[model samples]
Target: MFVDTSKEVRDPNVSAIAALDEPTRRRLYDHVVRRPSPVSRDEAAAALGLARQTAAFHLDRLADESLLDVVFERRSGRSGPGAGRPAKLYRRSTKQVAVNLPDRRYELAGRLLAQAVEESDATGAPVREVLHRKAQELGTHLGEQNKTEVFDLLERYGFEPRCEGDAIVLANCPFHALAREHTETVCGMNLHLLRGVLNGLDEAGLEARLAPSPGRCCVRLQPAA
Candidate 1:
């Protein structure tokens, strides 16, 4: 059966995080990333006082999760067809991983804020207006990319979406800290983002509304009048 690569791409962070759960793996990971050059399994084992086999196992696991990158080289400074198979070297992957428990996406907010500032500087538009517009555009684009149910799309983006009768209750704010620190600004941005999502989805039966609740997201999608 054909597999979904988009889902696969989004999943490595979870695997990478889980790979670090083992004490030995964590130590090896720390050690490898600290080195300026790639590390061999033997070198990692000796540095961390682990058996070569143990080090190799964890290293391979890290590579499997894309936490580490693998390369081959002749460690003896010799090159020839007769020189035998090159040693496998491991290095820190260029990939970045961020797994927020409540699924906060501060980075997205930061980017939008930065862009708004730059555009405001260039065109003398109000930064707040630029930010809200950009956020709405992004939300609309996100919704347009999906043919799945709106709730599924929200869940995929870590909204922790659930239903309360006819309304959709988002249980987690993906911008939790920002929302707390700058409630008015962030909540307004979020409200517009959800509105854009609804518009892009052409969801005539639902409407995005700001209805702050304790222990849940400040925005709710309710049935249209």
Candidate 2:
């Protein structure tokens, strides 16, 4: 799973012994995602109406794959006469492991483009020309900010940045679908704008790179055009 932190997590490692197939994976994903808490096997079973054993199997699988982190309530220094083991707690990892982001993507993009249209009309600039100019400006702006605070800035923009020394890794974006679907159209335009923005910020030669796969999302952008 960590093989490529630069790419979004795709088909996260699920335990084979736990009997987690794609369908089970989806159910388990929904269960954890809706609550964002560590649920016991019994709790997940009840939530999904599956057998306790079945739930346990899947929960273990998720943990093995690193999708879920298990938390154990440590046994007191002094154990009771009959106390066996500490209760195990389960919770979602802090990672932004979401499955989709079409709505938010379109929402942000629409606003940006709409504003561009209004500004173009106000200045009597050709729509395409104005957009191209704006794209450059935005790209330059982003580049400058990323120069010193790439991680912090990306987080603000909803892009998960996992820093490894000098390599700034983008784990995911809230606009994966929008970016892919409109890459050459709306998304491409946005990417160009980001390029311009980053260039201005001195982050030249950056590129947007996304891993092509299911259950993963991200757009790695270079600062330079």
C-alpha lDDT values of all predictions? 0.88, 0.59
Candidate 2 lDDT over residue span 1-225, tens digit each: 012335553343223323345687669766876785567777788888989888788777777766778897634555767666777767776544333332244565666677679988899886666666666676566666455544455654556666545445566645666666765445455555655645565554455553333443444553434
Best by lDDT: 1
- Largest TM-score belongs to which candidate? 1
Could you estimate the TM-score for every candidate? 0.85, 0.38
What TM-score would you give candidate 2 relative to the actual structure? 0.38
Q: Number of clashing pairs, model 2?
A: 30
Q: In model 2, what is the error at residue 83, expressed in angstroms?
A: 70
Clashing pairs in 1: none
Error of 1 at 18 (Å): 2.2
Decoy 1 TM-score against native: 0.85
